[model samples]
Target: MTVTHVHSIDTAPDPVRWPDIARVPSGVTARFGAPIAARLFRRAASRLDVRVALPDGTNLGSGDPRAPLMRVHRPAAFARRVAADGLIGFGEAYMAGDWDAPDPAAVLTPFAASAATLVPRALQVLRPLVLPGQPAAERNSAANTRSNISRHYDLSNELFALFLDDTMTYSSALFGEVPARWDALEAAQHRKIDRLLDEAGVGAGTRLLEIGTGWGELAVRAAQRGAHVRSVTLSSEQQELARRRVAAAGFADRVRIDLLDYRGVRGEYDAVVSVEMIEAVGFEYWPTYFETIDRVLVPGGRVALQAITMPDARMRATRGTYTWIHKYIFPGGLLPSTEALEQAAAHTALRTEGRLGFGSDYADTLRLWRERFTANADAVAGLGFDATFRRMWEFYLAYSEAGFRSGYLDVQQITLTKGGAS
Candidate 1:
């Protein structure tokens, strides 16, 4: 496999790669779908507890007077957007300044809670006809995986550093207690890593294989436990930063950060641990993901996987449908349900040992990140991101937060052992 080190982009990203984000809807969908969308949205909003404030001074929903409010600035444009793209359009409308909300996440929570039933049954049947499918070029093939990963992770190292904690852990942090405090984030991150390591049984002289290296924090922690770590990732930007962090932590000798796809990984390890990286594997490649781990692990070796999950029924409902997230943020990502994950593992020798779910902790983690990102808006702009990009990012973060906050999504740490052995 060819290895090329990726560097931070100096200027704004290429526009051709993001055609939909900055687009203005017109033509048939915009003209015809607007009025239809307006009626549908009003009907849907009335059922949710959140308040929707329209330009005509009409409010939908029977919630308290102070309920989380979604203020639609340009009702026609907002309706047209929803008509054209569904939830993706709603997000685009926010980026286009057609809507405003003091707390977007709060306003989005009730809608997320009613996700399965938000759209009328008649309209839900038209989803396959209306929504786009995953782009063929962005599929999780070995070659395409690099491009998919680069589209997001390789955007800029400094960009992520603005909102992420000092550890640079990108996945969810496991908060220690209820109502997680922002100041407790770094400690909670360490606790999350420690728990994964413990589950994988990493120790002195243990050989560890990490499928995703998010800036080397996990590798450094593993090396600190006297384990030899081989961590792989497809993102060049991540690999470069992770290597520097490992060396700075004085574990350069114990840790190896490689810019390699997981499918091509070759090694025999005592334990394999992957943090929330499986989402990018794509639903079709799930079996391959686990089988690779099984093939590379020694007998009785353990695996710890942290993933964002949805309900099994919901997973089946939305598997092939593309959304705002796939178009703008995570190109090839698809969250798995607990049942789907187990079924994938069953394809290999790995058997589920135990699992822990703390989705609310993820909601807290995202809240902090969003707050920090909003606070660092100037810094983000200085880094050369445009307002549309910022809004897209804000919506992405808040959208994800709402997913967990509403119990529509979950994050789980699952442990698996080879040969069904304890």
Candidate 2:
């Protein structure tokens, strides 16, 4: 097998290969692996609200009143993948054009609903047989965190602008009240940010610290409320744009956007806010991540965190697997469970004050992003991205949407306080 390190690119689409490890399964894993899992997969689909059309022109789970349809063009390769790696293979099938779905998220929702029980309970001990361990190169250490972040966050501002809302907030949005319009994404993002700031008690004379400044929108908004803000990020591309945006907002005097790691910060602040940033800290460093927040926060200081969480059981099961998402999108990132977050905070002075779950909002947010991305495909491809790159992004967005839609994942806005009573 050929081993080439392909990055989440900004300059150009990665070199396309027959079996690109960066995006799809490779060699034996792509072909001669497992057919047994394919048989089980067919059985599993029979229980869900989805239709799978095999290459033989027959269908599985037909007559489902409310399921999505998937057409397979290559059954042999698809079966091998599903047998070898389970869900990862299914994603690769989409990336490889082995399968097509009118509604990709819909096709995935049922599987996500049954993910925890995909394999028999007695066979759970053999998880490692199909799931691979975390890659050594992608381990989230202080030294490698910057590179891991750069892999995704540095992948061109032009590329992101093609899909993200005007605020450039890549995290989940809070569309307060249902029956919301699709175009309300930016407003929802602001609402989400404001809620976090309010929870952190950021206001006139407040000192605010923000980790993971994506183009500085949060810092600018906080500074607008007369707060002095310090925002840090390891992404050079992100920090550059954030600095410019902060200056453009006329908050350069009050808001400082720096290219620094959270572990390197020097001063204590009255409030700390990080929106979906902890997901990138890796499970191993979660304790240190929380400790840094605690140490830099003054006594009675408040923290507002917007995080993506999975059920604790799911988190534990997949924590060791280096997934396709890690290989192609986030590199070293890992979503945390609320239970894991609380456990990590056990050694810190921070305690959860209140928490709100809004997984549906994230589903809506992802749907909008995916639609926008699909609509702007021409502009995206015009940026030198190829067909393969485009498909990968589409799958990433749709996959996330399905995760939220299936209730397999959730987003939370949590308020924490220093030396809190809990």
Candidate 3:
């Protein structure tokens, strides 16, 4: 069988000339096989504003140069991959080190929203599920959790410290009630937790269990409100840091941090709250997860389940880049559509009490994190991480922000109560 070679440009033009943009490095030209791919590159780059200079005059293409970012690989291949696979290919290529942009979502947002772009991609995606390996739903064992969390969360706390707020809360978007004060985001998070507690009707001296607690923020705050809190997490680093924070805040008597899986926790509590943790649990385990919550909550107890959920069936069909997130970020992770959540809870004793959608605010929250991350790049690099790790993180934040901006993602606050509650 003869090989059908496709030649493509490896990088954007050197900010020198327009027509010269199509020129590929000799090595890249030889690797990609020439004229056909070169023509493809020229055509694709012509359609995008792929070039920009940083304040210091560094040439960066396909993203904001001053920010931690990357440019898509040979514009032609990126076009073809996205035209064929939608966000999956875009993310896959980035993870595979094939191509990159300052923000992968910057490259993807425009493509995802365009009917012209998606029509071809939808057709191509349907042609074949080119991804190799088992689907996340098929590999639902607990063994997968360690590696998955480590890929993103196991990074040094020092690195995260550079980007996250002083409190070190790393999950979901914060809701800024004031919209003007810098502390509004943290205040919003506290207020949201307060709302969860109020909806649960859990008062002073109530016992509470928190699943997937990050940095013990909710637990610490809840304890301050007079609730006894027990929190669990899969990350050892998070466990240690949260324990320290809880102690520092002098809430050790009220807040307990247990390094255990959510499935193993056995207790009856007045209230159970899980914030942004369900997505990482994957769809295959939803039944078990919900059952665990139902089992742990006492009769008339409340469960606050906050997560980032997709809105509808149509969005579910378009699973974004399984490759990048699976390999580099949250592995074995799947975002549940709202319908899926309701279906999972249908047979359980838990009843929905309060539901609020905070999807729009995530874009702002992510943007803030991006700004914080950008402002602290030197501190991040000083943490002894290499360029690749930095690039991976930058890509993660920017792409996520873009996803929120495009409305392909959502952040939701859902409160459920046992039988006999309002």
* Candidate maximizing TM-score: 1
List residue ranges in candidate 2 displaced over 4 A. 1-18, 21-33, 420-422
Tens-digit lDDT track of model 1 for 48-114: 8779888788888866987777878788778878888888888878777788677888888888999
Ranking by TM-score: 1, 2, 3
Candidate 2: lDDT of 120? 81
lDDT of each residue in 1-422, candidate 2, tens digit only: 01111122233224454254234444575455556666777788788888988878798985865568877777776777776676677777667776777778888788888988877888778778757777888888878989999989998999999989889989899996955456788899899999999999999989999998988889999999999999999999999998889898898899888889899998979999998999999999999999999889999999999999999988987898878798778988889998999999999889899999999999888888888788888798799877667778888988899899999999999999998433
* Winning model by lDDT: 1
Give RMSD to native, each candidate: 5.8, 5.2, 8.9
Q: TM-scores for all candidates?
A: 0.94, 0.92, 0.77
Q: Model 2 clash pairs?
A: none
Ten contiguous residues with the weakest lDDT in model 2: 1-10
